[model samples]
Target: MKDAHSNRVLLLSLLIGFIVVSLFVLGVRTLVPPDEGRYAEMAREMFASGDWITTRLNGIKYFEKPPLQTWMNALSFTLFGVGDWQARLWTGLCGIIGVLLTGYAGARVYGPRVGLYAALVLGSSFYWVACSQINSLDMGLSGMMTIALCALLVAQRDSATPTEQRNWMLLCWAGMALAVLSKGLIGLVLPGGVLVFYTLAARDWQIWTRLHLGKGLLLFFAIAAPWFVLVGLQNPEQPHFFFIHEHFDRFLLKEHKREAAWWIFLALLAAGCVPWLGVLVQSLLQSLRRTPGAAQERFRPGLLLLVWVVFIIAFFTKSSSKLPGYILPVFPAVALMIAHYLETASRRSRSVNAALLVLLGAAFLGFVPFMLRLAKRAGEDLLYQQYQPWVLAAGIVALAGGVLALVFDRRLQRDRAVIALALGGFFATHLILAGFEPIGQARAGVGMVPAIRAEIMPTSTIYAVGLYEQSLTFYLGRPVVLVDYLDEFSFGLQQQPALAIPTVDAFVVQWRAHAAAGVRDIAITRDDIVAQLKKDGVPVRIVAADARRIVIANF
Candidate 1:
């Protein structure tokens, strides 16, 4: 009882500290581009335009994704009045919700101890914590999928009454609906695929009857169908671009250019799991064995979880588009599996987990010297230099945490070992990510924002030439004209031909004309463009210049 009480106190303290740090970091970093800036700016545009159905990025019709994130962000802005923290609130909440839901579900399905461990494992994992604060659609998608996954677990647990199963299954459906809105069809498709694989592998066809498909499907369509319908009606072209182009092409073709080596996510899982990386394979292997429960209880949760992890990894691996976060949906499952393993984990297993963190920290310390070589562009060497100490500090923290955890594990104070490792892993990732502000701020064009904001008149025509600094428009609270730039916006620009300047010649004509009319023309363009404009006597007065870009004015 005394040990339990002490552990509870430590857990509560860690929970409080984690929440405080998590909330504080959401606002600390400048919204990084292109993902952070792009999504936040989309929300800002939605909030400003009051058109929730048709999403736009930089004043172009953006149908690349659904509007769930945009709606949530726009609503956040409405309530909180448009700041970086407010923009991140939705994804942040999603992250928190996922943790709580996973914890609750694990407790209900497994045991209270396992539930607690699951939450601790997930909340501290580098990937989960990092994505939680980031203003990305991945977190939103992962969050909703978490709800779906956990609901299914609770609904299927052996102790659940028929009523409990039905209601939770309904929630499971609603979560899929929200997931669809959050990302796209994958919300439903991925879960549905997992169910199919689970049934075949476990040979539990009876699981089908318990899913409450009729009412669940009705509820799902009711929630998910409206947005796709409204958006399609508002812009008939959205369906083709979204359903066919975005989904099919992105998966089947290498045109998205996100393709990585097939082993990429395998590597990410190893790193992203952090301290748990040592136990990952063993936990998954443990799932391959039958877990103790009623012989009549045909719902094999371990099999289901194993299938979830394998299927998601396999599904994304087969796709030509591979990104780090594609496997994010598996973290919750992995955490649950790890927690179950830790319930009976030997001292050796615990020692290895602690040791991995130490090695990771040492690796970070080792890599500190190579940061200078990581700079792709000029002036970034300084940013890398600035980032080294943060990495060093993170390494030290992880090393210390691992050493402490090893000591506790050796002493057989299992709970303390886990808690110590959790704290260490959590802080190590947070420090490294937070320390990235210098580099993120530089990439985000935040330094230029104040200077750029001061020079802009109400009628100033802002044009992004050759490149779009995604976060720049978000910081300024306005969209810019696109000049000779149509990378992701090509489909949107094809539909709205008038939203962009089309070519440099056309932009130059407009800039020269605006100058004559006493209008301020601000063009944030490449250094080469600024140089050429000056060399060609094109009337560009440089306002601010950076190694990568130059903010100029027509005067």
Candidate 2:
């Protein structure tokens, strides 16, 4: 009867996970402010061209990022149709796998309850849900790194069995190789840093013996090196730019010019964890109070989780370039730690659970009003905007989930009720965000494409004068002409004269000349420049105008 009850609990957990993740995955689209549209479009181009060597954005050599992400999207596009869904499929799938792996690892190391909680927390994390529904590489890289960590943990746990340890070690190395393919050296560096720190801190030299270093190194090279060598051979000029300029210099010297103070990331970490921040703090505090023997036995995992979080935050904090997604890999460790805390809590700790539930409920309630204020401040017409309904719905669901948790806590055992409520809240939040939010944003971009297309002639050149909008480029299915604005783009334009305009004045002068010479059809926004052109006896037609950008054309 006990066994049957345990089996039933496991089944119930699985059902909840499946429902939550499936809802999160539903109606999802690759549309966000920055990376999603850019990366998704780039992948579409890669699929269309069948050339995987170089990535092109707006039809220029886009050597800024590696090709692994584009390759994944291309493969998916080939299998599925070229739509937002196909573009974002890999990221979402990777997220789901990462959550499952986190749960499985927790179950193996701790117990079934911990595993279920770990999976629930991870799947519902705001950062995880947001990154998973985009076309960016961070989530994919995070997933790979999580796999490597799990392998290492399993290997350590089974050190008595040399053969099993060896297999798990190989899995770790293989996962590291894929992590390299996903992002870069940080994949190996971050995890390696954690392991080294844990070993030294714990005084566990036996870990070195179990690693099988010689064979593991060979496996890593076999899986990861070939692609690097082949791609480097094809583009000899790429090595210095990619390795030194893009990776090392950008992080160390602020070459990218995106510098933020260290405390900013600390604040971001707090926000990223969301309503669970209260519980996370409690977990960390509890872990610090463990006894010596208990600490030693569990300290490796705890230390590893700590190092993962600290190193990622510190590394990016000191770097010149920082994005919220850069620290995504740290989330799994956070989830695991939180799971461990919840599972280890005594049944008598009802006060702790009650306090956490109240705090979470308060946070959820507070978020709704804050969001409305943000919408108003941004000058967005919430009722008319496509995303307004989705955001409002998410806010409503979050509030309801929070209220439900608080109410249910009074009617049942504090620990189980608290866990159930937390999980339910997260599930509701993730489902709303994944299913509705992204699609609304993506559709807005898609709607703009038609206006852009109507203005450009099939043969007339389309150029991004000051920026490269990847979404527009992908929808248009052509290489864009680029006008000079900055040094890098200026250099690129010099290399390709057809894409360059010498100066803004020169461009305006040429445009006027063309207009005088029977170019009667010209489209522009209703701006001061258009008014000036009209005043100067140049005919101009209004094309399209939006809160963000204006679409213009010349015939």
RMSD, each candidate, Å? 1.5, 3.8
**Pairing residues by index, what is the TM-score of model 1?**
0.97
| Candidate 2, 378-398: lDDT as tens digits | 345452245444445555555
Q: Report the C-alpha lDDT of model 1 over 416-510, residue by residue, as the tens digit.
A: 78878888888988899988998998888888988898899999989999999999889988999999998999999999989998899899988
Q: What is the lDDT of residue 421 in candidate 1?
A: 85
Q: Model 1 off-target regions past 4 Å?
A: 1-8
Instruction: Looking at model 2, report the run of 10 residues with the lowest lDDT sum.
Output: 518-527
Q: What is the lDDT of every predicted structure here? A: 0.90, 0.66
Best by TM-score: 1
TM-score of structure candidate 2: 0.86
